[model samples]
Target: MSVSFRLGILGAVGVLAAGLAHAGWLWFAWVAPAGALDPGSAAASSWMPLLVQGSWTFVLAAAVGWQLQRSGQPLQQSLALLRQQVQALEQGRFVVVEDPPAAEALPLARSLNAAVRRLQSAIEEAPGQGAQALRRTARRDAATGLDSRFTFIARLTERLADRGGAQTALLALRLLPVQPGLAPDPRALAAAAEMLHLFSRRVPGAFVGRLCESDLALCLPAHDLVAESAHSLIAALGSGPERLHCVVGCADHLGGVSLGGALAQLDLATAEAEAAGVGALVCRTSHREEATPQEEGALRRQIVEALRANAMELAAFPVVDAQGDLLHLECPMRLRLSPGQPLAPAQAWLPVAMRYRLTTQIELAGIEMALAASARDGLSRCVHVAAESLSAAGFVSAVRSRLQATPQAAALLWIEIAEVSLERLPPRLRNAGTVWQRCGARVGIEHAGAALLSLVRLSELELDYVKVASDFVRGVAEHAVQRERVQGLVAFVHEMGARVIAEGVDEQADLDALWALGFDGATGRLAGRQGTAEALVAPGSDAAACRDQAMSPA
Candidate 1:
């Protein structure tokens, strides 16, 4: 294969041929034109034969040169083609060589194509084999081996976009934590995660997402969602009404929705199932419901008018410690459309406010209401500000001005923003925190579960505490998985210099569990009843009785 060796073999063969030609010419006396000695000549005239021999030799040499040039054209062409194929391989393309390689390279081309096919197949089969595809992170959930929430959602969005208005079914399975108030065995959580994961693999192209700590969503074509698959999933995830179990809610969409609306539908369906009871499964086959543009505009108009007219009403709820001591009153301000109109709760209109980017005004209104009330009664308050508000132009300056106007309220105010909102624009959040500090007010993140996965990231924010989402705290006393997750979170957050406030601790058992687990404080109706803090809350003390009513539909 070496060039030197090839040249040596050719040289040896050339020498042998030349020696044989000389021997035959001399032995037969081929110097004469007749190719034999002339019997009648004393000394042969070598010149006469030399002329004839030279002419013939010239013709033979010319013919050989033409033959070699023709042969080399094929070699050059094949080599160029081989180089092109190699470059394509280097670039990670597995294209079939449309023009077969020359006979010499054909075997190599075949072998390379075979290797590429094998790698391509491996990439499709193993998520970790993404090197061929050059995708980062293996496009999966590291813990459960399911699709990560972002990946699942993105893939689902692509499918919906491709087949718009197509019938699609989504399963939102909210797993209730079991063996509450104890550290969950990681093996147990893994088993459950894998159970759902395997179920998702029943049909090819199944899309699954880890929506939150306890929520997993599976999206597939409507036709693939049959009773048999449902039964198998329930069996694997633990099906029973009397025991703690994961309840699945199914929502069917009719090509009439975007990804957001479809997800919202699943949420509503899940809520329906939760209300129904254990072993409950709710299915909705309705067309996706969406607010008309006109309706949305009208809602925005109402919120704007209310903000302009100072029509915000405070609904005070108590956040208490384990000792039933109220740390502070969370005054979630609500909006009223016109004079005498009942106030709309945060849930009812916050979504609308967020949608229209009206959160800046809403946050300002909440702070102003809380400040006014605190100044009037000397009560410490925790007021909510929308995360979107921080992005508003001049929002930090506005907060500073509000605080400066009632500097005394600063000491009594705690501004709460949803963790989901705080997650974006770290610089902006840091700036807001700086403003809060300058104003002598405190800020904390609320609804921590949806936006955060680990506690270490909390150090990035300038927050005093994080309110673990109510879903994590609601049944902590009986849910082992929830307890372990919250426990780790609390420990990590403490190390990060922030307290862990468990939200929605209405049950005595839940409260007791959270306290034992080192939760700094908590909030809910139960906490409110036992609160010892002497803070003056809403204008009417009867707001305590309206805790349930305040949260109800307007």
Candidate 2:
């Protein structure tokens, strides 16, 4: 029987027992009176005893009810404690609640204790197999098993947390054809996971995780050999006709910090990799000298004020044709804290801005600046789009609207999306290329050649231009093989109906070599010195005046 029902029966029994005792007392009282006195007196005494006995029975029933009511309090308390413990567990905390010894509460207490034990066991076991499972889950592009995005973030996080004397490095392995033909089959993801698991086991003290659907992160904890490690890891993926590329970023002496801080640093390092255009990009987060509290505080304050006042500036570097005619301008956003202070690159403020969820505002402002510049007669503009902004449906729509409203300048505006960012685009915004194109705006992929695996597939996307990475063009004149390779790339792009622009052209020889290589345009330190907006607006006039003054006999 249920506990309540049993209690009810016990209470009823108690009442019955009291009633019986009361009846016995009445019988004794009545019998004694009858034997010792007259019939009338005995009858009256018997009636009085019966009345007293009935009153006692009522008192016993009340006592039983009171006892039952008091017992309910402990049950309520036990339930409340159970709820609190469950809440704690849900929040990823382990909790042990001591249950009362009452018989009614023992079952619930035992159940809770059992659950806590199981959870603790799971926690203890996670480092071994659990970590493996998480790696498998995140390793493959949810669709293709190439690599998932989460795997990258996790591996980078762990690497950043490592403090062993050995050097730590992060390698981002992105599969070519970042977007596989269709939704990746689960079977494919499983296969990819197995392959990666096997691959990871070969590397000692290495942890692999997913950073996104298409990015896999590999962390090597005890290696001073970043370059060798990257080459080995890539080689293990096997020699194939198709390129299997890995972008690596490494740091030595990465110390302990909050997870958020580590992620922030990882994001910066990744950006550096993308910008650097290496087959593998490696960065050391630990500097020879640490930033003092005062310095960090000042930087933080300056960034805050810049964000608050929307005072950041966007600067444009011209991408000129072989004959030195401006084909378009590569507009990289720069931030200036105050007059006379040097401007900082987007990487400097971008991470914190993202942490603060201010990417959209910053991107929008950049778009405005680019459009304004393009609207000036005889100028074309290419501006970068952050992956996060592109992932948002609303932001895409807003950008489309803005482009449409500026149709006269839209064709001149080339929206450049990085390969990494492109991989993260949601389905709703996957057709962003089509959307932007329909609005009379052109699109291009920046940091090209870095992710050679994705190059051919992305090429098939039919972008308007491809900005060959600066690193690839660093010393094109000095290396025959590099020059021929660049020439071949320019030819291939031209055949695809897309223009090729070489970035990071810092030397006169690099610019001259690019011209001979059939590159349609070039942009970098060597193209021309960067100047203020007003100076750029009158490039011809400004240069003529300077030349005239310099040539004047002195």
List, residue by residue over 164-250, the lDDT tens digit for candidate 1: 344567887776656555443455556667666776677666767765556778777764353346556677556433333667787
Clashes (backbone N, CA, C under 3 Å), per candidate, total 7, 20
Winning model by lDDT:
1
Once fitted onto the true fold, the runs of candidate 2 whose alpha carbons sit more than 4 angstroms away are 1-305, 336-343, 376-378, 426-428, 529-554
Question: What's the lDDT for all of these models?
Answer: 0.61, 0.56
Per-model TM against the reference: 0.55, 0.46
lDDT of predicted model 2: 0.56
Determine the C-alpha RMSD for candidate 1 after optimal superposition of all C-alphas.
18.7
Model 2 vs. true fold: TM: 0.46
Q: TM-score of predicted model 1?
A: 0.55
